[model samples]
Target: MPDDDYDDDRDDETRRPARRRRGPRNNTDVPCPECGARSVRPGPWPWYLGTIGAMVCRAVICEECGHEYDERKPHAHLPTRKRNLAIVINLLGFVGIVSVFVLLGVWIYFTMGRR
Candidate 1:
């Protein structure tokens, strides 16, 4: 191998700067009820899973005072309810698919054994 083939062609000035990734943005529209600051952001989790509990509500957290609360009307829990319902439907679909594959395997084993 020749040493001339490994030489650098481009200069540092020609290279583009690396882009910075941004995290979740603050919800400027919704203000904190405790401190009344417009620094509310989305909660860690949207649904109830493990320790994170935001079920049946659009949970939000204020950056200024660290106050957490639901963004939607307290009485109207339709949106979050619908979200949970969708999750149930998806789980059922997964179960159905797995059951179908299991049935197919059983049928194949019985048919092949007779032959």
Candidate 2:
């Protein structure tokens, strides 16, 4: 019985500590547009034509003020200048991708289709 008690104490000393529970990783570092608290988290998915359409928009909510906004447009209500710039950048990227495809097609037509 004394040996069993000693073994139990040794086991407790060797046991690993419980890990700290981490919050959701999505948008956690972003500051809230309303209160500026860095506790933003991805909100519940929007219900449109059910779950299929919910994937279209990503809503981020502030834990401090309970303010929710689109992830792409991080401002409180309307889009900010930074948001507009992001939109322009995304559009330029899309245009560049399309132009690449068009150039590839033209090259293929001239090289293979002509022969």
Candidate 3:
């Protein structure tokens, strides 16, 4: 009789330890954009380090839509402004050359008439 009680107590203690070690269940349910099915997987890390500890995120491409999005530093517009200024300077130089030729032609014509 005492042996039976000891066996019952041992079973209860083992079941209690099992219940205490129980963990929560994981639920990861998401649909995939490519096939419209529930088969989504974890994506890889996409980041790169630039100058001065600056990090840039890589592009995210959509498999279903075939679209790509890039992330980078924007280029400065100083080069374009310098090019426009050079064009304007060249245009002014051409106009000045034309004016000099016209003035020389008029000066020669007037001098020949005086002779």
Candidate 4:
């Protein structure tokens, strides 16, 4: 009985640990735009990344209706104040560029005339 207990302990010590369970990888599930199915998957790799449509849009394919469309949400317009600020900044940049050119031209003319 003592030798049997020692042998059992040795077997337990040499036993491997249990394997772990893995979860899903890249399980991007969304509603299909065309068929309105709730099982939309991500588009194909590499080739899908190379297309112009991929650049300007989100690439997703509907498994139900086979419709490949941009998955991007409709863009919301900026507030009027923010739009006005952007326009003002753009005009200021233009004015600064023009002022730099005029100053350079005036300096060149004065320097050459003096020489």
For each candidate, what is the lDDT? 0.62, 0.65, 0.45, 0.58
* lDDT of candidate 1 over 1-115, digit per residue (tens): 3544443334443575778886545657666667777667676553333332234356666777777666664233445654665687568779999999999999999999996
Judge candidate 4 at residue 20 and give its lDDT.
88
Candidate 1 error regions (>4 Å): 1-76
- Higher-scoring candidate on lDDT, 1 or 4: 1
lDDT of 4 at 40: 54
Number of residue pairs clashing in candidate 1, backbone atoms closer than 3 angstroms, sequence gap of 3 or more or interchain: 0
Per-residue CA lDDT of model 4 for 7-107, tens digit only, reads 99999988968778754333344555556665456654334223443454455666667666545631222233234445665677799999999999999
TM-score against truth, every candidate:
0.34, 0.36, 0.33, 0.33
Strongest candidate by lDDT: 2
Show where candidate 3 strays beyond 4 Å.
1-76
TM-score of 2: 0.36
- Per-residue lDDT for 40 in model 2? 74
Ranked candidates (lDDT, high to low)? 2, 1, 4, 3
In model 1, the clashing pairs are none
State which candidate, 1 or 3, has the greater lDDT: 1
